[model samples]
Target: MKTRKKANFFPRFHKLFAVKKIFSLLFAGGAAGAVNGLFGGGGGMIALPALERAGYPVRAAHATALAVVLPASLVSAAVYFFGGVPLAVLLPVSLGVTAGGLLGAALLPRLREGLLSVLFSLLMFAAGIRMLLP
Candidate 1:
């Protein structure tokens, strides 16, 4: 059996630090964490940009977002598990999404650069329109 090597910095945060910065990290982590748990997809999208604006390096921001997401994902999964959600329905969708996400990630590097921007903008516009609908 081939042992897979541990990948480094798939998500990492290496930055300068201070006492006050701990609070910032905690706050960023918590806010992003909750968004991830509550809404699912928008947390990373919002967190990365917001963290960049707040002076974190892009890589660090992503790492922070991932850090937050890890716990939230676990908790959400736990809640679903304990809440008597039918595993039959959840299992197929979870597997489908996991497989689809893997394929998307693999194909990501080969895709057009502006595609994400256009898609995100459209989603935001659609959401705004949805909000305005009577």
Candidate 2:
């Protein structure tokens, strides 16, 4: 049986950029990062495609994007806590998200590439329609 090789995370981070891909990466990352920073979700929804276009493997791009977002989440959580968001409400949601994230990490490599983009786009479309409906 052939064994799958593990990717070096930092090298993969560097690989996301090539001379020709600089603009694409900047635009994608800027757009995704801004929305994610503002809304607290949807960055990954944007990052995956940009990273893919820039030539990173979907799995690696997703992982790297998640890593990039981790600090953002932490800061957001801190702000919510300080702003008097209830711990009781926050705890369960946080736990569920963390558990689901762990599960997703374990299973991500097993999923077919490009599926996430389709799912994410559909989700955004649904969200948009829902907002419009009300």
Candidate 3:
């Protein structure tokens, strides 16, 4: 009987952190944090690809990106709160986001990799085009 070595899905995480890779990851994370702080969104756009390039599988990368961005999002929200952005204005949007997140989580496991990639690309492209428009 032949035995196959189990693949390490996050190889970069398992090994000793190299200085170059550490800098690259930090740069990516810093950029994502800055974007989140400035725009109140879009951090996942920068983090997902960075994590994927660092050897995470697409699903793992997406999940990890959420974890990575959560703290930044919280801090950004805190700033907005202190800046007197009305909590009532955010309440409805927050409810919708929570519902959508539940639906997305339920669908993620059943989604095909190709379909997910195409959807993600289209979303990013649409966001870019929208941002570019007057």
The 0-to-1 C-alpha lDDT of every candidate, in the order given, reads 0.70, 0.74, 0.87
lDDT of 3 by residue, 54-134 (tens): 888988999999999999999998998898866687899889999999999899789897988899999999989999999
Local accuracy of candidate 2 as per-residue lDDT tens digits, 81-128: 576877799899989999999999799789975998699889989989
Clashing pairs in 2: none
**Model 1: lDDT to the true structure:** 0.70
Summed over model 3, clashes come to 0
Each model's TM-score?
0.65, 0.63, 0.73
Identify the runs in model 3 with alpha carbons over 4 angstroms from their true place: 1-15
lDDT (C-alpha) at residue 44 in model 2: 74
Worst 10 residues of 1 by lDDT: 1-10
Worst 10-residue lDDT window for candidate 3 reads 1-10
- Per-residue lDDT for 16-108 in model 1, tens only? 443345677567667776777776545666567667866878679879766656777787767666868877898999899999999998997
